[model samples]
Target: MLKKLFLVAAAAALFSGCANVMPTGGGSASDAADVAAAAERLRIAMVDPTRPALSTLVADELSYGHSGGKVDTKESFIADLLDGKSDFVTITITEQTVKVVDARTAIVRHALAADTNDSGKPGKVALKILGVWQKQGGDWKLLARQAVRAS
Candidate 1:
């Protein structure tokens, strides 16, 4: 009788584990749309100097390299913008590509172009930016961003 009881308990535990493994119906088409929208909003915010709220979407510790140089942190990133390090920061996302790599992860590809306006006029600069966004606490936040010069 004890052996039978043990077997029953094991079966119950196994079934319970299987129940938890059932799909939660996450990562649907709507989720993909929402991710794309969020990414575009972030791009808009980054370019619009008046919108401070958009900046929050960016990770506080972002690393970026510009004009064929080394990567830098968020603080330096902001400083660069304010100090006229990047002449014209025009983020043109030719295509907002959202890929749901997992239930809670997405990758957004943004086609971008920038001009260094430190000389008081826009200079020629073009690049493609890829941003990785992670869903955190019901909101999507940018976790990482990288730029590759568009030849």
Candidate 2:
């Protein structure tokens, strides 16, 4: 009974705080829902790169652009997070929208505010982000992202 309860709790945790994206005559529910899941997981994974979810959440060809005009590939992005070059202390995301561009693509937009430590210096940042996510191998993967400073 305890084991069953634990499993149930774990499943709930996995699905919590994420919206189910049912089709609206333009996109697929499963695909949209998976994109939502991916976006959420990416946030968690950024603050804790030890989570294996990072590996699955991002695509091999990801191009992650920062508000400062720097861009990182998937490897560099994960490495920076893991290595403390960009250490996330706290994050709040708002105004998040997922637009399914097609069967295999999605556009995720959000406003993000985060407290971070970069190169051991503490700072705060606010930005509007646009992400391109592609469905590959039956899973949604982040392909490209660009961030613009929110004024």
TM-scores of the candidates in the order shown: 0.67, 0.83
Per TM-score, the best of the predicted structures is 2
Prediction 1 global C-alpha lDDT: 0.60
Compare the candidates by lDDT and give the number of the best one: 2
lDDT of 2 by residue, 107-140 (tens): 8888899999988999999999999998899888
Give the worst 10-residue stretch by lDDT in candidate 2.
16-25
After TM-score superposition, the amount by which residue 138's alpha carbon in candidate 2 deviates from its true location, in angstroms, is 1.4
Candidate models: Cα lDDT each: 0.60, 0.80
Question: Root-mean-square deviation of each candidate, in angstroms?
Answer: 17.3, 4.0
Clashing pairs in 2: none
